[model samples]
Target: MILADIPIPDLELEAHDGIDVPHDLVALSEPLEPGQMLLLRTLDGVHRCAEVVGLDFTENETIYRLTYGAPMAPEIAAAVARPPRSALRHWVDDIDVEVLLGELADAARRTATTSQAAAPESSW
Candidate 1:
C-alpha cells in the first residue's frame, strides 16, 4: 500500500568546505528519503550531483548531510560558513514528541545490550 503523499521541503543545501579533508559537505534543508538522488544547482552556474550518504537527527530536524563529489565553489563555502550557527532551529510544531523520546529509549536499550554482549567475564 502507498503511504499518503506528503510534500517534502525542498533541500536548500549549502556546501561546507572540509577543513582538513579533500571533500566538501553539503547540509540539506530537508531529509532525503531512502534511495533518493539530487542534481544541485546554483544561480552563478555551479552544478553538481549529490545523494545522502549520511543523516544526523536533531531534536526537530533530521539533517541529510552529503558530500559533493567535486570541489565546491567559493561562494558555497561562504554560505556554509554562515549557516552553522543557526542550523539547529526548532520546528517541532507538528512533530510527535513522544515518538522522538521513544527513539532515545530504543537507542539506550540497544547500547546496553551491545555493551553487555561485548563485555568479557573475569575471574573472581
Candidate 2:
C-alpha cells in the first residue's frame, strides 16, 4: 500500500516524564503494520524519521519497535544527534502517520534551498 495513502488516526507518544504526548487524540480507523515509515515528534517537538521494524505484544498492550534514521532536518539534528541506544519502543497507539510524508518532503525542499544558497556561484 502507498504509505501516503494510509489513513492515520490520532496517536500519543510515551514521554519519558510519564506523560503521554498526544499527536491528535483521534481514534484510528485502521491499524499500522510493520515496515511503515513514520515521523515521530519528540518531547521537545523535534521531528524524527523512523521505520517500524517489529512489534511485541504483551498480555496487556502492544509495543512497536522503531528504528530511527539519522536526522536530515537541521532542527531534528540539533535536538538529538543520534537515536537512543535502545531501539525506540512505543505503544502502537502512540504513533501518528498523518502528514508525515508531507513534512519530510517540506524538510527536503528546505535543505535543498539552503544548500543552493550556500553554494558558490560559477563564473561561467
Candidate 3:
C-alpha cells in the first residue's frame, strides 16, 4: 500500500451558514478517502464537518468539493479550498483507502522528485 507522512497545519474555516461549527479544523496528518467526514474550515472562522463529495488535486494542494444539504448554494460550492488536502483525515477502514493512499503516495513522490530536480546542485 502507498504510504505518506505529511505534516499538517491548523487552519480555520469561515462560516458559510449560521450553523457553522466553532473553532479551526485541523487537517489530519493522515491520508484521506472520499465519502469520509471532514472538519472543513473557511478563511473566515467558520467550521463544519462535511462529507467528501469530490476531490481535485494540484501540484501544490488538493481542493475539496463539498456539499452540506440538499439545494446547495452556488456561492458555497464555489469557495471550497481552506486547510488544503494534505490535512484531510483518512479512515483506515474506508473502502477506497487503498486507492487514496496510492494516489497520495504518488503525489507526494512526484512532489519530492520535482523539488529535488529543481534544487540547486549541492557542494561539499
Candidate 4:
C-alpha cells in the first residue's frame, strides 16, 4: 500500500527530495475481478500495489489483472518504470525514500527475529 492510501490522520507524504503530491484510490473490480491493483503517482515515481482475491502463486509471476490508474505521459511512465523516486505528482504521495527503506529494514529484522524464536531449536 502506498503511504498516500495509509489512513493516517492528515497524513501527507514527503518525497526523498522533500516534495509533496496528491493521490486517489483507483480500483478495478468488474473487468478486473478476482484481484485489484492500485497505482500511486508521487513526486518520486509511480508505484503499483495489488491484492489478489484468491491465493495462487504457482506460476513464475502471479498473473493478476492490471487494474489501476497510472500516469499516461510517456515521460512519467518511463520514470515510474525505473524507480519509485522517479514518478511525478499524481496518484502517489512523495515520501522520504531513506526513511521508508530504513523502516522496511527494521520490519524485516523484527520478522526474522520472530521467525527464529518460533522455530524449534535443535542441537546436533
Each prediction's RMSD over C-alphas, in Å, is 17.8, 14.3, 16.9, 16.4
lDDT, candidate 2, 1-124, per-residue tens: 1111112221333222122222222123454467866665443444456566776666755555655544246544433344433357542232233344455667778888999999999999
**Alpha carbon lDDT of each predicted model:** 0.43, 0.47, 0.43, 0.39
lDDT of 3 by residue, 16-63 (tens): 321222112324455456676654444433434466566666676655
**TM-scores vs. true structure, each candidate:** 0.31, 0.39, 0.29, 0.31
Clashing pairs in 2: none
Which residue segments of model 2 deviate by more than 4 Å? Answer: 1-30, 74-124
Instruction: Kindly list the per-residue Cα lDDT of model 1 for residues 33-118, writing each as its tens digit.
Output: 63455545444434444554666666765555544445344334333333223347745433445654565566667667877999
Q: Which candidate gets the maximum lDDT versus the true structure?
A: 2
Say which prediction, candidate 2 or candidate 4, comes out ahead on TM-score: 2
lDDT (Cα, 0-100) at 14 in candidate 1: 41
Lowest-lDDT window of 10 residues in candidate 4? 15-24
Pick by TM-score: which candidate is best? 2
What is the number of backbone collisions in each predicted candidate, taken in the order shown? 0, 0, 6, 12
For model 3 the TM-score comes to 0.29
Candidate 1 ranges with C-alpha deviation above 4 Å: 1-31, 71-124
Q: What is the lDDT of candidate 3?
A: 0.43
lDDT by residue (1-124, candidate 4, tens digit) is 2222322222233212112211222222222335433334444444433333442233443333222332234333333334455456444444555555566666667667878999998998
Which pairs of residues have clashing backbones in candidate 1? none
